[model samples]
Target: MSSSEQPVGEVQVHPQPAPPGSGPWARFVTWAGQDTIEDYSLRYAPKSFRKWSPMACAITALGGIAYLADYSIGASIAVSHGSASAVVAIIVAAVTIFLTGIPIAYYAAKYNIDMDLLTRGAGFGYFGSTLTSLIYASFCFIFFALEGSIMAQAMKLALHIPLALGYVLGSLIIIPLVLYGMTALAKFQVWTQPLWLVLFVAPIVFIATADPKGFNGFLTWAGDGGTERVTAIGVGAGAGVALSLIAQIGEQVDYLRFMPEKSETPPWRWWSAVLAAGPGWVILGAAKQICGAFLAFYVAGKVGFTAATEPIQQFLGGFGSVLHNDTVALAVATIMVLLSQVKINVTNAYSGSLSWSNFFSRVLHIHPGRVVWLGLHIAIALALMLGNMFAVLNTILGFYSNVAIAWIGAIVADLVINKPLLKLSPSYVEFKRAYLYSINPVGFVSMMVGSFFSILAFYNVFGDFMAAWSPYLALALAFFLSPVICILTKGKYYLVRPNPIREEIEKEPLWAGQTLLDIVDQKRYELPDMVHDCPFHGGTISSLTCTLTKCHDLCKTSAYIDSVTTATLRNAAEPQPTT
Candidate 1:
């Protein structure tokens, strides 16, 4: 291992072309065979692979956020601010998270870049964005622990299971499912999302509709000292913690990358689906927070105030009132908890595996495949669960949110502002490691400066409003700093150079105006077709039109998309070349 560790396929700048004329499969497999995923996923999400619609993707993306903590947030905010102040804080946070999430979702879908790739082009460089990956991975593990803890808590409540075993089961439950990646995740989310929503909402619905007077009291009720005053400082403190969720957009983008490119489909419907699934998750998330508050308030009223912050308790208690059967109620809560955790944790596990693969590959030049890192990632999450991270959800999430929001805010600022008005960054996104600098000052610097000050404020080092909503301060600082850095640096770090690569020639369509042809050479054979050679896995695929086996595209005229490759054409590719 030399000074750097980037595995052969982790992604790199100026990747050498497959040693001049290797077998087509060998070359294709080498260039894009899917190196442990993090880097492989950095490139285009192929059309052959895109199967889910935007709606399902959105629902699944929002599935994991069905966390028990929403109740805790609602109860904490309500208790601290009274119902009125909490309502204001929830609304402010929901709207802010929604608006910021929109452009991010759009870009991820349209361009097919994961959060890391988006950051690479937005302002962060190849290595620079790894810091953000670390930040993002932190969310995954921490949430992993938090969600597991909630499940463990539920287990303790419903079955008297040990918290330790519950923790182990909660984290491990997602392992086998996520191993299959999105294919399994999509089905899991679809089968379970409806029940989760119903069970999650039934308690709030029954309590509110049944007791309007009680609900009214909840809304008007003030905290111990909250009466006769609306302290902006108190409101800001509550709002700050809520705003930390702004980073949740990164999770949304992770799935949005699977969205198929917009085509002849009606622009309105396609855009709407992407929009609804992407940033629109914030709308649903905010609604859940409100719903959580309602549940917490109702549960507290029915079962005393001390237990208000426990969501599993609140939801179970609420569900029990309507179901009228202890066993049924128990089952619903368990199903709800398991489904929500799997939906999100699978995503967490999947995204985290990719992140670590990229980090280790780039820094160490190793490619251990996604499965290897997937195990490692779960281990980290398992360790955290064992460490009792669940008990300190507020502290861990609050600090993590500061860094996550700063990174996300910088990327958003570049996409929404820098690319359009200033023209500092490119219009399209690029994720190849070969095409980016090790670090870009624009995103990297903005995030550090923002996170540094924001974390300080979070610790009460800044005093006053700065202390209460430090995460928001980080968001603001990053947003302001990204463009400022772009202007100051003149946006040189956007890309070392543009990508001119086409992974598969079939990806390009033969249009109505363009004559299409496929020609194969029989005599100039280089190697036996694997379809013919490999007997272990019988050639399960065959297509006369688009043969699954590699054809003589290497020698065919149609094979050479251009005589010149992307590297040779980068200087040649004029931005937005004419048809």
Candidate 2:
């Protein structure tokens, strides 16, 4: 039997690589097919693999966020608060999302790390970031289930299928599509971009052309709240609900992390790609949210509040006005919902797997693979779907936004304030587990305080006014508190130990007559000259190494890189057979 298949006690000293087409599914299950290391789970994305142009990557990343959920969210807000508040809230949320997303997008692309990894070095520290991982993973699955629920509704409307089975099919469809990761997703997004854009705008255009009265209705709609003019509480509550989307930057980072190095690409192209794919997502999202409000307003008079809030129903009504036939309108709306849901859910599933992988690998000290986590994320989302998550959409998002905003706010403060203004934190992100402290109070404490207060306010613990503005409170506290804590701690907690090897190499030229190990002190380092494969980053390198004990203590056990010698040592340390 091959070494990979052999029992643990009889592990091979030098296991041979699996031959071509000899994997679990003959070939489809191979790591190559799975885009094994392309997404750079445990390490930085290398320059060689980031060959896609910035525009190509940006468009793909933007395409994934082209979901109908924005429409649902906008419609819900408009239905509850009226057109003025919904419009005000969407604008407020868009501006906030755009501003906060900038620093995160730049850093993720520049550093070549996902949101979880970025959170680690930005201020949260190594193990401190585990909390954000959970938050991020929750964002993925929650949105996945939400997007899936919408797809199921479309299925019920278009195919006349039962909601129970529709939920299962909707949840199951994206698994195979997301299995291949960014390589496949990039293509899917690019190919579908034109069609998605066409369908997305068509219903709005038809409303403008065929039913001008409907457009006017959207202008004066007061909604179920019976508030014609925007109120402070309404705006605050609406913004709070809308700001829950702050975590979307984390999703954008999932794609931005794949961006090629800026130095290698043209300056204009690189910056354009970074901004467009990063903070620029809100541009499109804002437009969709407005369209959703418009549609909700147009439909509310005919279908009632609850029914108007549903994207499938809203679009069905919109298309019905234009198409003049119920069957044709249903077909068009169903196809739009399916296309949009699939586009977004693949992203949700892919990012969730990455987040879960980071969280589990750090917490459990083992990572089976991204594919394993992918299935786990989908399964959880499916469970949520079965529980009828669609019914509690507003409650779930309003509550979730507080936690998400706190997490993003803290990270942004560290990047924008601590890193640049005060220089309290390190200028460059230090994600290597070996060099970072397990917990940095700067981000962790700030996030905790922010989330705690915001959540309390959300539940009316802080009274009605505070409850209405809880998300702003969360953002304010996290953003300001991060700098305060960084100043208080004096940035000493950012690193557990100084990385003298990295320090020494920075001063020398790349072509200097010395290897990276030549600068590393042999007495302080371990496994010198042997290649080290980072368990977290999935990169193989020979420039640096540390002892198993040191690796466990500093890097966390799961992120420890393995050299040939270390592998053999690990094997030897395993319990020996009896006579």
Candidate 3:
């Protein structure tokens, strides 16, 4: 044996490998999804694969967030709290989301990593991020169920399809669309952008111009409960409900990971693309919510409050106002609903698949590819749809907003507060499994403390006022506690092992356009920093060890090259000796 060679068992394997296809229905699962593209579920994205310009990538990401749920959220709040209070809550939520999203999006784009990977590096640690994945996965499916329900409503009105069948069709339609992952999603979002904008905006404009009286009335509308005054309680409650969307930034960064490097692009263009596609999404989203409120008020006057909450019914009233022809109005309303829901649900399924991939990979040590998770995600959402999740939308969002806000707030605190102010966490985002702790208390403890107390408040354990302020309490606790925990723990738990050598290699100029296979095949010179997961060995090992006879044949198989290897090859190819 060579002096540099180490036995495979030297690298510890946690939880074992499930005895090679031992999970329930493992064979069927492996057969169902494409394994060719790993989607960088567990690591950084390499430069060679980042083909899109910043502008194109930003727009594609923004397309996924362009859902009609804003309208639904806005309408639901307005219906309960009145227009003035709902408007206040919408503004607060928008500003909060926009501000926090900036740092997260920038990191994801700059590092070529997704939200899960970003979270791991930011503070959650490797397996610690698994909990967050479940949180984010829940966000995806919750929204998926909401968006799917909206589509089902559209189908019922247009094609006279039953809600149950429509639910199945809506959930199933996204499966094929999302099956191809970001490649198909980017094109789908781009081509549909123009049509979606037209359908989305045209009716609102028509309503404003044609129905002057209704438009005027919408501005001063009060809640059905006769809450005309905008109290702090009402605003807090409304904001909490709307704040359930704070984690949508995760979905935005999912696509932003594919953004072209800023070094190659003009400064103005890069910043503009990042801002517009990142936190800037909330600007338009906030406007949509306010617009939803207006439409809800207008529809309420015509068809009563209960029916007014339905986007299909609300838009139908708007179209009917101008079109006069009932059949034509129904057609336009249905088309708008279908287009909007389809666009957003595809994003939901895609993001969910990524979250689930991050989760299952860490917990189960199984990677069946993202498509299988996509199916599993849609299946869960379909069940939620069948249960009629939309009917209790307010209850669902009100409770969910706390956990979502806690997750986002903890990340935001780490990025904006803990990293810079306290210097408690590392500056660079380190996501590779071999380098991170299984859990990090800074984020996990803060999130737990925040969620636990807030959920208590939500259930009225502390009484009515605290119940109404639960989401805010969650946000405040998580944001404030993150830095506190970091200080106390001295950020010791952030890394279970020393930083990987790839961190230094990534900074080297000669690292690009190289792969582990190149070294193993003797196509390129071996460097100490060129690391890859050896097929014969479970852990990431440097190409310097590629000469070992036991691992020589395994390195030839490209599938065993792993997702992180290409990234390491492309970004950190050139290595320099340590001082």
Candidate 4:
């Protein structure tokens, strides 16, 4: 009831039960019950919360996918499967990605929850979703290494930056930019997007304009063996490498969550932005892959056998062929790589921190802040770089794609099909720990089954060609199986209970951590600004730190008090206010 500033360390919050008349325990209990975030989870996504236009979100989401590795990944596929095979693989992967991402992007934007929370509410429960979080976190680091290596190579090839220095430069580069979250990321992407587009298209334009044979070379390119001569296994193996990039959806959702709520003013633009920037990003990605494949073939034609495998070399040759000076090509290439990696890695680093924070805060019950994890994630990628991880990209990414595909497939099924048509589960997303089972058989069983079968397929246990297309196997199986499991289970695994406080808040509104929770047992709403979700005895009046004190009374037995009681106790926990 007191009008005081938030305090520092050990701050307390919540209701005062006494009408200047109640006993100490009752008042403290009322206060303790009011500490909110402890029992609350992200709920009630609303239009008011979506402040950005769709265009801003699209750029931010797609910005991270622009790594020069597109060239390397495409080249590896091209060299292995021939240009035609790589072309087929690119189209297949792009179509697959767009379809898979549609549900995820729409759900994330509509629900205003991150992927981890979505996993929990979709069908995977608290502990079950943790597996996805780990999967997602692993995706962040793996891509961080891949993208960082590409940047480092650009540095090394263009500026002659020592590989060691390039590694440090590449790895540390994202931390500074991602620290600010989506706000800073949006501006950064906006400023850089134009130049990225220009640089990306320019070399292709020049190459095509100057050497029309370049196009012919790409089409007729035997590439070790022509397309018809392709072994199914070769195509499958190459596709697996490209499919690993499917996990990039996690990063895309990080931005899509910021998409402006749908409206009539510019409905077409909004939908266009969402489609183009959301899952539509795969179209751009596939295009880049085609470009990569073409340029890789061009480079092989020009550079001969020695450096044909590397895409940066492919790019350098493209520029040398298209431009006047080799030095100019090199400098432009380095800048392009630096800009591209910096953009996407900022997203990787940013999205990773959110992923890691959600991991620890929910599982371990602690949050130091988003910035701390930024450093930790980048450090991990740095360590991977020292190990020269890029050297083994093909094998590493191929194995990783299977699990990533399975996870995505399970999630997309729940969002697109499960929640909408059958009405077996609620359409509005629910993501709170207090109301979910430790595991949901629907998503969990589906993911496990998919992963199991896909891995077996990958190892040639399901025959040779199947082994090559293991990621697709996982995707297909998980997507088909998740809903079947949901139907058989009657979709019971989705929620523990509806938000108890829905009446007080808007329906489907996005909630911040500070959003108050009603701890009905203690009869008051928790104060929203406390640093600790748990009630504290007040220590100071300066900031959130001083806003709490522990329960002072001997009568209260349980440490796990409700939000309202915690709020009451926060007031009652302190020395009585001098009248």
Point out the worst 10-residue segment of candidate 4 by lDDT: 539-548
Instruction: State the lDDT of candidate 1 residue by residue for 1-579, as single tens digits.
Output: 331442221221112235456665344335343422323343445444566776777666766566666666666677666777777778887877888888888888776667766777778886798788787777777766766777887888888899889888887778787766667667777787777778767777766665555466667767544532455666666666577567677777777776755664468866887777777877777777776666667677666654666677676767776677878877787777766666677877878876775665556554435666777888898899889875565566667778888888888898898889898887666555444566889889999999999989988897877776787888899999999999998988876543333122224422211211112211111010001111222221111111222332232232242433544678767687579
* Candidate 3 residue spans exceeding 4 A from truth: 1-37, 505-514, 517-579
lDDT of each: 0.66, 0.78, 0.78, 0.69
* Predicted candidate 3 versus true structure: per-residue lDDT over 460-479, tens digit per residue: 99988898889989989999
Worst 10 residues of 3 by lDDT: 7-16
Which RMSD values do the candidates have, in order?
10.2, 8.7, 7.9, 9.9
- Say which prediction, candidate 1 or candidate 3, comes out ahead on TM-score: 3
| Candidate 4 deviation (Cα RMSD) | 9.9
TM-score, ranked from best to worst: 3, 2, 4, 1
Model 4 misplaced stretches (Cα beyond 4 Å): 1-50, 224-231, 263-267, 302-306, 500-579
Better of 3 and 4 by TM-score: 3
Model 2 worst lDDT window (10 residues):
7-16
- TM-score for predicted model 1 compared with the true structure: 0.79
Taking the tens digit of each residue's C-alpha lDDT, what string does model 4 give over 367-460? 4455556668888888898798887877888888999899888888888778787677666665645445679988888888999999999888
What is the lDDT, from 0 to 100, of the residue 478 in candidate 1?
A: 95
